[model samples]
Target: MKKLFLGFCLLVGFTTIAQTVADPPFMQDTADKYFFEEAAENVDLLQIASDRNKAIKVLSSHGLLLPHEKIIRQDVQYRPLLDMKLVALTEYQGQFVYLTNKAVLSNAWAGKLYINHNIKTPKAMGIGPDFLTMIAGENDFAIFKNNQEVWRSSINNLNPISVQHDLNSGQFLILTATGLYQVDSDLKTVKKVFEATNLTAFGFYGDTIVLGTTNGIQILDRNTFTITKMDQKLPWTEITSVKNIRGSLWFGSTKGAFKLRDDGKYDYYASKRWLVDDQVVDLAEGPDGSVLVLTQKGMSKIDFSPMTLAQKADYFQEIQRLRHIRYGFTSDLAMKTPGDISTGYFHDTDNDGLWTSMYLAGELFRYAVTKSEDAKENAYEAFEAMERLTALPGLKGFPARSFERDGYEVGLHANGFSEEWREKYEKENGRIWQLSNDELWRWKSTTSSDESCGHFFVYALFAELAPDKAWRDRAIHQIKIEMDHIMDNDWHLVDWNGKPTAWGKWNPDYVNGFPINVGDRRLNSTLILSFLQTAYHFTKDKKYKKAAENLIKKHGYDENANRPASVIGFVEGEDLSNTWNHSDDEMYFLTIPSFVNYSFSEEQKEAHFNAVKSHWEVERSEKNPLWNYLFALSGGKNIDSEESAWWLREFPMDLIDWKIDNEHRKDLTKIAPNFRNQTYTEVLPGDERTLHLHNGAYRNNGGSDGNREYAPYIYLLPYWAGRYVDAISAPQPE
Candidate 1:
């Protein structure tokens, strides 16, 4: 019986496929789940080092030191330094030792105590096989074994900079401002191996010594001692620290931290996406094969956990349920304290119904595929919230943009726009606030085409796929009233003042008013045609089809709808046609499902298919799963499922709106600004940038500060819809 039920679920998941394509292969395996956490308190970080157990030890100014352990969370263990000003930090034999102004100290099980070191005024410390090496003064270096100084020597007065032990050669390597030196295990003589100026850091890669200078990298062969200067191909020069972790060379520079990949390319980690600040001071191997980056503000741990796409979805689902739901609708979370999730509150937006519909539609798809009762409840709750919008305004078919309880100041007057702009706006569109019939709420007016697109799309899905009869009838009735409103009012969503809303126009005079280059001309035609067809498909009414036919034949909408995105260039002196309208893209994609699915004939369906294909061809570089999955519904073979999976896998688990700036990176290839506002030739991974909304251009750089946390509707919709259409598989067995 269990196997039979599983087979039925798979059948329902694949029921919406017009044609089957190979699912994304990466969905069958574990992918990287990336997230970051900051230190509890900000401090001026000085040095960071890791032990064999991967516990990180951090030293700060004024004798502040903390040991960090990674278990369920990045836990900071505060151990007192006994008021001794620590100068450097390193771990030896699973114990953290510190070089202080008074003496060398060890943080063992007892407490902070002296290490009985004979060296005076230690400047730096390094770890060896059985001994601890320290730079004693400007020209002296000392070696200690069993907490006692064994050997002390004066170099050729080169002015020591730092010290480290070479594990491959079993020698204590010394770095000076002018040259590099090494001492054997006997601690007899220190010999200068290579000469270099402005040396900042050094590490070992196999049998060669890799030196980091302010200008570039220098390599020296241990056998021959021949120096080779390599060209600098880093994001920024001025290397501050270097480490060889798990056979990979990681570098810390003035601008950011990056790793030298085996492919000879550097994996750059910059901006707030990966660190608290761009100025990375130190780097260390962290727990679970992560990296601990120390900056002026604090420490940031970048962790990569193995997870599947379904696991990522489930994680985001919990986040949304915790902070994004408000009044039974998906809402944005505004943080009272910037970047602090604990001080967040859900706020309403103008597209509340629209966003809720999207989330609700995804839940409907999830319920169809998995038959989960939780998903059904989520869809029903969101539907009720959206349904309340239509009835709140006291107008049968007119839906409010959003609603808030009484006594809240909102709308145009409260938005702080200039008086001249507000006056002009009022002249074009009427007053945008109305009191609910119950006198206990206020509803926002001037509903746009975006809301209508969301309404019809989700209502049609529920009408066709809902498991319960009563729910399906409710969905059908809602679609009828909304379509009747547009048709009865001559293709305009009439507002409370008996006038059409600003963006709710679909009449011939309105859609045909703009030039062919304007996006609204094509977008409005597609929307109304889709709306009429969807109404006819479900209601079986002859008038809706007749209205659609009249618009297509008499209004030249077919030619307009088929226009390519290539022709959407800037038109001189036309405000609406000056640039690409991304909002139009969102509305078009949402309406395409109904436009293609409920077509009057196969010929019309083919036209819709061509329309989607053209749009997808331009947006293929975005690698958006939602667009790809929607295109596959029209039987598109080249849906770019791999790119879609890339989008899903690269999405960061942290949804906070961190200010990400990639413009200053030298690794990016910049392009001339075009009509689409595409500044770069290639899009950065989702983790490297901000969370992009469907209406946002992915090619754009820079984003808002951490003041808002977006919901998971943007991700949930595409993921679940792809599962329903066979573009993506369920989580595979590990």
Candidate 2:
């Protein structure tokens, strides 16, 4: 069952990231990979000079540091001066380790095994010539040639022995496309275990191998070759790579990452970013056995030290006390800090910590649900956190923007690090968009430029609970800024930034990153329409009604690229990323039909709907991995029974949660004619296919180019699909 859910993995391969590819139109991939590059530079520096912890500190060369979590930080210090930039870095004990495929071998290591001499598939002198097979062990090693094998050197004189594969865990987990055979240490003959039918990753916990596919996490008992499964309903799940730091059993999927716990259920922390490109590269115990991070993001220590278990436990206890956790919104995460960049963030762009702190607290809040005593305590903890968080700090000009209670950054629109970026943008060529360049930047400021859509959710919770006029006014004002994008005299939704050159107008780099850019009208328009619709529902804000009507009236169905549905969004660039384009159309599907049906705009609605009905083929086209009913929901609601049912039943139904669509980009249909095969998209490799590879994260623009932004519809849809979920019960405006 789990294996069946992994059917979509290979079908989502995206653009070239590390290798050579065609040139981009203009805006270069300015994303700073310095941390990765730096780590790679120190490859082969993994000499065991003494304590494993100290070696790790030395190897890090300051590229990473340790934090305290469940795993305690090792007390160690070392010199620094890393040469090669890192692609992958991990600290085990005191020794710092790095990976560089192009490395010259101060000593060589491939996969995880260190080689005395470079491994060689020595050429055969005769037909089917016998080759040397070297096996690794704790101290000793063995070599096998032909059918004959011998053990030599070090501890136990032990060699890797073949063991039966656990079907639950699946056989043959593919790492680097190389098949890894599982075996037990206490064995003699090399026997063939269950050859994996087709899978990517597996988690080995003592005798149990956990397979993580879209369906759920399946536990395979190696001895019995039996499969037991545990599935949590969600969009995705993942199993982490091995971490030898604390002899731990760690894994992560749609549910989250976990460390081996005595209680059997692993201690967990879940986040889309914590996993790899939708794959868990490593479930590593860092310098400190604190929070185990299941990702490839290069950093020695993930600083979760401040979050103590007692504090978290108390937090959990409080969360369990409440039924629903309502939160207020602020613009703290959206800021660019003050004084540096050229682009202006509409909100709290600097203190990213403000949002994440709440997000983390939210995690604890969620965990409290299972324990009732914890529930009582968790509610109080969350409330305290929320009130304490109300006063956002770090605003530059507005004193009112400063949350007085906590002294954190606060504001509604056009503020934060982006403002700082706007101040220094031309000079720097681009902006970090977040705050403070410190390596452990979890509590800092940031965004993907396309971040405005979710801005109100945070604040709306606040409005729902407290109903402050100030919060209401601020939310309303920020939304109006989106309407300002339309032409005053004509009212057509022109390119918001008004870039003239084909590329400049759309600014792929500016609009398609991650959180999303406000400069995007199709997106902002959809959200704006929805916001107004929502506001009118709550406040009867006629202003929103007026704006939605005028905006829809001025743009009409045929104004964009000739097709009404295609007109859902406009790009000033020569081309659009898969993520951006697909999500753009979602806005139309989500709002236009409902808006028309409800507001007595039948004639125009039918016309626009007809445009959409005509272009429906293009919107659902499979040539790009970016279109679907999901986008429709992002803009409005995914109330379709078929789509909803499919989502619920097949929603990450297994431990190995991979959307394995075997068809190549050209072979798949179900999408649109212009789309089924997107040779038309001229985007960088990493830029176009990023969304498809996320571990249950937002598919912002689909790829780095922003094609899969429609991905969020998968989660956001049920909220507005008129379903009977508790948080919001409003139906589409009529």
- lDDT per model, in order? 0.74, 0.31
TM-score of each: 0.88, 0.33
The lDDT of model 1 is 0.74
For every candidate, C-alpha RMSD to the true structure in Å: 4.8, 18.0
How well is each residue in 79-134 modelled by candidate 1, as lDDT tens digits?
A: 45545567888766667777876567665646534565545556776777655554
Q: Candidate 2 lDDT, tens digit per residue, 175-263?
A: 21122343322243333333333233454577766554444455666565466555433223433333323456655443344445465
Query: Per the 3 Å backbone cut-off, how many clashing residue pairs does candidate 2 have?
Result: 155
Q: In TM-score terms, which candidate is top?
A: 1
Question: Looking at model 1, which ten-residue stretch has the lowest summed lDDT?
Answer: 1-10
